[model samples]
Target: MIWKEARNLYVNKWILFEAIEAYSEDGKRIVKDLSVINAYDDGKEALKEYREKHKKDKSREMYVYHTKNDELIIEERMWMGVRKNG
Candidate 1:
């Protein structure tokens, strides 16, 4: 479902979702299609779930968001760090 649809379905709640179809434009992550993983009353719970899922699968584009947001405008940031090779 789209962000708007998700927002409508899960009103006034925190949700953990996977971005199935998305793109970056003007330093923003625009999610076109997504799948809702779970809903929560608290943002922290959603974030916790997102972290666990992300840790298990780094490839998946997952996020925690509140349905109160009118737009799903995620700011994209470049990760700047040196990684030591194992």
Candidate 2:
């Protein structure tokens, strides 16, 4: 997986981030992973390190997000289906 980072605007916190593949049918972006590798007080420094790691693996998916929380806020949703088989 790719390496990424996110910053908390209010608290001024930086965190490493990544996204994982999830099932999808249409052109809509689905589930993702916000795994926190580490946290930093300086956003610039955190981003600098994140860039270096990203450069190493350019083939993986990564993102840098600035949100209220340093980590990603995951929301659970129920999927509707036809039935369950034994």
Candidate 3:
């Protein structure tokens, strides 16, 4: 879901997630279309849960952000690519 939708749904909460996306032919994932993995309340308990989950798989793209910051969340992106030799 988009951050705006998520914000309306999860007010005063923190969301932790890894995006579900499609990969390109060159093996790069397209992040514009992302599905949230884990959604948790923003609290000490949630922090503990995030820590445990993050430790198990460090490669997972995880983020802890508040619903209030919808703009920031929506704009966030991870750039991944290697420059080709000329």
Candidate 4:
């Protein structure tokens, strides 16, 4: 489903979804098509679930977001190098 449709369906809730079709534009991720995995009352819970799922299958594009936002404005970042602990 689209972001608008998902927002309508799950109001004032945290949703964990997988981006089926998406693209990066202007340093932001624009999800064109998505599938809702689950809905949660808390953002932390949604994030925890997202982490687990992501760890299991790194290939899948998943995100946790609240429905209160009008649009999905995910900022894209580029990681330059690996972090080293001293």
Candidate 5:
């Protein structure tokens, strides 16, 4: 019901944010951006405000995707011929 603080990482930086499912004027699915409440965003206070804002929209969905420095899964083929021989 409430917009939880959603966090993601980009370029090794933590990007804390929140989103509430909303339909644009033309009825297009969209996510409304809420300001970052805390530095790392604990999602406590922000969720409260988001619920209050779109209380009537029962169909709306709040999504939170957690990321930390972002772990990258790399394959050996990606490195091509630059890898050192062991």
Candidate 6:
């Protein structure tokens, strides 16, 4: 998974003062998104929940936390080709 966030921090009065003006014209600070990659089963479950929760969105976003074991599951949709070939 990849996430990003934006922050507002400045030093010089020139930059800071200019930023204040820009913020007033536009908007507030942006979110600073920090993301994590899960390698364990718990993380996979979290990903599952994320997928389910965001199901209603027109476009879904996902981070492939754990897919190898999922691919091995003998399910109808995914295993049909392998079974037929075998």
Top lDDT hit: 4
Which pairs of residues collide in candidate 3?
Answer: none
> Of models 1 and 3, which has the larger TM-score?
1
Q: What TM-score does prediction 3 earn?
A: 0.56
Clash-forming residue pairs, model 2: none
lDDT of 1: 0.94
Instruction: Residues 3-84, candidate 3: write the lDDT tens digits.
Output: 6776777777777655655344444443444445556764665667778988998887655667767463334347799989
The digit string of per-residue lDDT tens for model 1 on 1-86 reads 99999999999999999999999999999999999999999999998988898999999999898999999989999999999999
Candidate 5 error regions (>4 Å): 1-40, 69-86
Q: Of the candidates numbered 3 and 5, which has the greater lDDT value?
A: 3
lDDT of 6 at 83: 41
Model 2 stretches with alpha carbons more than 4 Å out? 1-12, 22-31, 67-86
**Model 1, 62: alpha-carbon shift in Å?**
0.3
Off by over 4 Å in 4: 83-86
Residue 79 CA error for candidate 4 (Å)?
2.0
Off by over 4 Å in 1: 83-86
- Arranged by lDDT with the best first, the candidates are 4, 1, 3, 2, 5, 6
Cα error of candidate 4 at position 48, Å: 0.6
- Residue 40 of model 3 has an lDDT of 70
What lDDT tens digits, residue by residue, belong to model 2 across residues 1-86?
31223343234555555656643445443435446555676778768877997999977544444445533444445779899799
Model 2 poorest 10 in a row by lDDT: 1-10
lDDT values of the candidates?
0.94, 0.54, 0.62, 0.95, 0.38, 0.28
The predicted structure with the larger TM-score, 3 or 6, is: 3
Better of 4 and 6 by lDDT: 4
TM-score of 1: 0.92
Which 10 consecutive positions of candidate 6 have the poorest summed lDDT? Answer: 10-19
